[model samples]
Target: MASEAAAQMNFQTMEHPAPMPIDQRTQVLLTPGFGTQFTDHMVSIEWSDTRGWHNGVIGPRHPIQLDPAAAVLHYAQEIFEGLKAYRHPDGTAALFRPEANAKRFNDSARRMAMPELPEEMFLEAIRLLVEKDNGWIPEEEGSSLYLRPFMFASEAFLGVRPAKRYKFLVIASPAGNYFKSGAPAVSIWVSSDYTRAAPGGTGAAKCGGNYAASLVPQAEAIERGHDQVVFLDAAERKWIEELGGMNLFFVFDDGRVLTPALTGTILPGITRNSLITLLREEGLTVEEGRYSLEQWREDATTGKLVETFACGTAAVVTAVGRVSGHDGEFTIGTGGPGQLTQKMKDRLTGIQRGLVADSHGWVKKLG
Candidate 1:
């Protein structure tokens, strides 16, 4: 049924009239700093209660016009997904685990009470945009085209109910390394005053509000000279849930790994899931269970916990070198990128960029 609906949903293409010149684009791609530079084109689709999903367009990247009373402006009915298009060695482009992203996008929509987009339709939108703007993909070693697909309530109503109209848009950004600190590993600051999500809240949803609620704490972390902020469970305020925008993992000395269980709060990260599979395949014990702040400090101090890392789509895999909060600071395994962390990052990135064989068939090539 979703394949049938996707086949019927046609996208009208309109090329950019005055796209960026080749030389200028090359310069921009040379050092495309994360999300600052954008591609020439974007994808847009509209949805409504009566019309369903219609009016699909692949056109120039432009500003979005919204009514003053739009529900998204007030109620924050928005959800989004982030994935990347990698330029392989053979001059071809591919996406890693895009199907996972599509599924997660719908999951977020379901949680936010927004209309679910067909998985096939979601992939089709991404394919159209990537193919149309293929030239924007950076050829650098660690660079790719970052794709952001987002949906929001477009209906101009002040009511407290779900909006009847919605709009979905996909934009491409030429991205480089997500972190600019050039540190061997990133330092994290534990947030004691602010929590990311409650048990029945939107923590698991990739909505704007969850991130908005994290801004103050994130700023506080930065002010304290940390790269990222790690949040604790709202109820206990001791169990480590996740970082501001990534997931956590603890590597132990006994060849066992543990990540905080997804208890309706932590975002089910695709990178985190893939790493678990890879670790288990490598004959390592992987466990998904609650890890507390007290336990983390104790294990690190006692040499039980050797390496800790954070995973996500943007940062891929980054080791947690130092942890600091009101209680004090502690170092994890020489306070540098651990050997296991580097190995996992290399393995994951190798599979992503086609340097290694993809036995899991996670990469979807755009031909």
Candidate 2:
């Protein structure tokens, strides 16, 4: 099997002879902001249509050389994934729900007309990088090693078709809290002008274009003094979609949880999925269906919607304190982090940090 061959593939590692000194590395780990500090090494793998995957290498982190006519430069045939490696209480490293990331990466590849990597190879690549960069895992309370695995077309051709060659690489950074506001919760700006994705588009794919398309609206939100932007559906521009980089969830006063359904225009978020499971475990009703901006405003005004939050790999679960739109602005439940929001964050972080029992076997321990 192709996957079997990839599993047997040996990675030649060339450790950095002159890595960052202990003192500097320690200082970086102390206050390393999100995606600002890097580890010493990375993983690289090459693939071609003729030979399949080969040349697995784990080498010192450095710049990548690309030809001027590289397909990715022109066509943007690329996909990426984000995950984290946690430092357990016993000093061991673990990954939370890595298999899910692997699956999503392949799904994105499929949608982009790129080659689908073997799931085993994806998992192995992550393991190799984390093992070699073991010292980079920060021990800070809310800090971890952020892993970014990405693949891009490498063929130096200008044609608008799938490239014959590709490269996959995994890099890591030690990250702390994502938000620097230090507020109890975050504020969102509803974008009535721009939409994130449209039907039968690349909305479900974890590719770069989706995020690229959201930058303008995000800038508008920032200009308006909001923390993030929440986009509406492209078709009608009335249905509630998601945030610029995260998924949304609404908590009602009657113990009901609702999130925007995935209708080929929403990214199926892993954190959102996990929280749905956790909410069900707590005997709460969870619904994934169409929700409109009008309904959101009405609920918030009538005190029916008690809390709202956004979830992603970087931010985990962040409470949406208030929402501002073209018409006006309103607050959600005291304009601060709600009780259910804190509970979900605590339970999830507890499982991740090994402070609680792993009932679902979501934690994969690494050496």
Candidate 3:
């Protein structure tokens, strides 16, 4: 299988002579704001039809040389994954379920008609980057090194079929908090004018096109003074799908939690999955099925829906305090983070930051 091939390829490390100065880097790391600051180096691996995968290198972060007719620029054949490397309280670096990211990345590749990378290769690339750029990881509470691993078609020919050549790279970012509000909750805009994905479309795939299609609606949400945009099912435009970049969850007054079922149109979020397991462990009745926006409004109005929140790698878990659209607006649970929402966020974040016991074996400690 592809995994067997990946085991044979050794990652070659290249020297990066000019790293950021200690004083300057320390200052930047002290107040690193999300993805705005990057580390000194990166990891890259090239793939082709004739060679499978070759020319692996961990070197200085630099501008990539691409052909004028590169397939990624023209056809947009690209996919990416996001996860964080945590600096534990014990002064060690670790990752949360990175193997899960590798599996999802390959799933995205299969959907995009791209080559499947070996899981071992994916993990090794991440390990290499986290180790090389160890200094970029912020030690402050709620801050970590964000890892972005992406692949794109690089063949120069302008053909309709999949490109024979491809490139996979991993980069790191020092991040603090994703939301600038620093509030216990976030506001959402119901995007009735724009739909993120359709049935049997690339919605399930974590590709660039799915995000590209959401930018306009997301912009509109921001213009209307919302933190994020909530999308409805493309078919009926009635049932809830997810947020622009995260998955939605609804908690009931009766202690039941409901999230949209994966109907091949929603990104299967790792954070969402982890929270589901954690909720179930606490004996919660978790339901994965269709939940219409009308039902959401009715439940919130009648005090049936206790809380609403979204989950992702970047935001972790954020409560949905307000919802608005062209139809009207509504508030959920006094327009603030509910008790359960805050509890869930705290538990998940605790496990990720290595403060609490990791019973699920999700944390992979690094150097």
* Candidate closest to the true structure, highest lDDT: 1
Error of 3 at 80 (Å): 0.4
CA RMSD per model (angstroms): 0.6, 0.8, 0.9
Candidate with better lDDT, 1 vs 2: 1
Clashing pairs in 2: none
In candidate 2, what are the lDDT values of residues 1-367, reduced to their tens digit?
Answer: 7579776779998979899998999999999999978999999999899988889999899999999999999999999999999999999999999999999999999999999888899999999999999999999898999999999999999777999999999999999999888687999999999999999999999999999999999999999999999999998999999999899999999999999999999999988999999989999999999899999999999999999999999999999998999899999989999999999988988888898788999999996
What's the candidate order when arranged by decreasing TM-score?
1, 2, 3
Candidate 3 lDDT over 204-301, as tens digits, reads 89999999899999999999999999999887889999998999999998999999999899999999999999999989999999999998999999
Candidate 1 C-alpha lDDT tens digits along 1-367: 8888788898998979999999999999999999999999999999999999999999999999999999999999999999999999998999999999999999999999999999999999999999989999999988899999999999998889999999999999999999998688999999999999999989889999999999999999999999999999999899999999999999999999999999989999999999999999889999999999999999999999999999999999999999999999999999999999999999999999989999999999996
Q: How accurate locally, in lDDT, is each candidate?
A: 0.95, 0.93, 0.93
Q: Which residue pairs come into collision in candidate 3?
A: none
Instruction: Spell out the clash pairs found in candidate 1.
Output: none
Tell me the TM-score of model 1. 0.99
Model 1 poorest 10 in a row by lDDT? 1-10
